[model samples]
Target: MKKFIIAIDGYASTGKSSLAKQLSLHLNYVYVNSGSMYRAITFFALKNGLTPLNKENIDRLINLLPEIRLDYRTNNVTGISEIHLNNKNIEGEIKTLEVSEYVSLVAEISEIRKFVVKIQKSFKNKNGLVMDGRDIGSVVFPNADLKLFLKASEQVRAKRRYDELINEGYTVEYKDILENIINRDSKDTKRKDSPLIIAKDAVVIDNSELSINDQLDIIIRLINSEL
Candidate 1:
């Protein structure tokens, strides 16, 4: 069987990562959460006091990018790849609301995007791959075999994020999550470089009212049609 790439692009909290993870497992493909790469960088900047990104800090972050090492290691228990920074597993650290707040700002940097994109492209060497992020379909893998742009209403997305954080033991307000989602949507779409736009031939999946199984079925049918 010929292996192919699936690129999933969407706004924050739109379940891009979740759907990509599921698809990867179902197809026995490599799964890459591109947003986690940005979050790792943001976490690094925050840890090193380089955030609130002004011109000076941005330049510093760019210079410091050389020292930042990122890689994915699959967990034996879950069989899912988790990102590591500088040989340390910072997966749990990068999922906090604080990281979410700064990740979009970090992703907006041109140098950072270029650095991450170079790494993202290398994943194509895998036998098969499923990658998800704001610009995966539009920028990273424009020729992907199947490109999905996921969307959901702000309220639904915020609620989903809120529930996730709460279940993770973080006390968060739904209003704050909603605001972050809105802000991220604006920043992601208006970013000067690699703004989130649906590829001309990509399929748009409005999963606001759909379940995960429903999405999986739809994508499976599409893949079968392509085959």
Candidate 2:
């Protein structure tokens, strides 16, 4: 069987990561949750006190990008990658509301994208890999054998995100999350570098009305057809 790159692109809380994980497992491929990389960078910037406009500080931080390592680990009998920076696992910390708020800001930096893209490219090498993120299909792996763009209504996505955060004990308002989703959608589409766009040959999936299994079945069918 020839290895191929699988790119999943979508907005926040659209279940891109979840579906990617399932597909990777089914195919025995490596799964890279690209958003976690952005969140890790956001956590680093916050801890180092580098605000959005602090170019020098941000550049200095990017230089340390090589120290970031991500790997899947079994925890509590479930498998998920532990994101490490300089040898310390910051998975739990990086998923906080603070990191969530500033992640898009850090992600807008072209320097950071370049730094991470280099790492992502190396991982795909001749691809038996599943990678998911905002611009994965269009930017990170444009030539991927299979590409999917996932989307859902703003209210639906916000509700899902709010519920997830609430379950994790994060204090958040549903309306506020909805507003943030709109704001992120704007920024993600308008960003100067590698803005999110559905690639010409990709399939668009509106998952708002679909169950997880439905979505996964659709994607698996698409992948099979593509292959």
Top candidate by lDDT: 1
Off by over 4 Å in 1: none
Please give the distance, in angstroms, between residue 10's alpha carbon in candidate 2 and its true position after superposition: 1.1
Candidate 2 lDDT score at position 216: 82
lDDT (tens digit, per residue) of candidate 1 on 28-49: 9999999999999999999999
Q: Write the per-residue lDDT of candidate 2 for residues 1-227, one digit (tens) a residue.
A: 67788899988889898888878777778788888888888887788777654778777777766666654443444454556766677767886767777888888888888877877777777348888998888988889898899999999999988998899888989988888888888888899998889998888999998887898898778766768
What are the Cα lDDT values of the candidates? 0.93, 0.81
Q: Which residue window of length 10 is worst by lDDT in model 2? A: 71-80
Clashing pairs in 1: none
